[model samples]
Target: MEHPALIIVDVQNDFCPGGALAVPEGDQIIPIVRAWAEDFFRQGYPIVTTQDNHPPHHISFGERGGPWPPHCVQGTLGFALHPALQLPPHAVCLKGEDPDQDAYSGFEGLVEGPEGHREPLASFLHRASVDTVYVAGLATDYCVKATVLDALKAGFRTIVLRDAVRGVDVNAGDSARALEEMAGQGAEIR
Candidate 1:
């Protein structure tokens, strides 16, 4: 596809091993994404890295009656991206910041792109003339899946880098099911 952008979703400390909402082998995708990010950056393609930065009382928190434990909380180390991921200077998107809403898709997040101002991901991507989205990063069943679905709905040619993803699998085989569902919904699983 032409004008492809790389969307790395929620590769944060909290989703890695030993953190609050660890995804199995989640950190394992770091090198894969790092390599891809470097290539995309060198190619002058847009690279968008995402974070799940949430307020302490975010609606998705168990403390607020949601199923998930308070994770990726603002100002906490868990909210930070993993040190080893080494992404280039690219757009940064923040999700789960709204205390009243739980955002899983990067499309729902706001991007702090080269403009140095926040705008919706879809708008930023569109402004960049992005016609395709190549996705990577954590939790295949959750954020990655959600991002892919949204990208397709937004009418972009969406592709998932299967080698660069892992999942929490809150339920057994959820990750596998997510990939199938995404493909079924028009996302190419590469």
Candidate 2:
């Protein structure tokens, strides 16, 4: 049977309030995400969490001339998932670890492996026979937007939990615009 997967994207400390690259009220969604994950877990569905685990000199850091401040550096406290999120050890955690790649979508992340091969998020879902994906997490305008679009591109039925996401909102209305774009591309905005 085809199951629905939960893609919780970038709910790390660095993205939350009082961190390196804090999104306004980013921590507010943790409780909701945790509750949703628990429900999925109870139903025996796959839960995939994405983390922006960049290196100290990652290209996405403004200190390295990127657009944003340094955040989610690997091995740092900021890179860890928020303490309040009680995820099971079996839950898949995909990390974007490339120093030069800006992996906004969880599906686009290049996780380090023994043979240096990258594991795409879609492959995991396909392996588990997942045909639908429910996404929620920090920064709706960026990571959430990218993940939802990629999910649609991968032929999965995608749904974005609007109340369970926050955005960087660099342009004041970026979050709203991103939701519109996602809706336009066949993603349900719940």
Question: Largest lDDT belongs to which candidate?
Answer: 1
Please write out the lDDT profile of model 2 over residues 1-190, one tens digit for every residue: 6479998989989899889989999989988898898889898888888898888888987878999888888889999889898786435455557787788898886433355565677776787899999999978999999999999999999999988999999998999999999999999999
Reference-based TM-score of each model: 0.96, 0.92
Task: Give one digit per residue, the lDDT tens place, for model 1 in 19-77.
Answer: 89998888999999999999999999999988998998899988879989889998999
* lDDT scores in order: 0.92, 0.86
Q: Give model 1 RMSD, 1 decimal.
A: 1.2
Among these predictions, the greatest TM-score belongs to: 1
Which segments of candidate 1 are over 4 A away from where they belong? Answer: 113-116
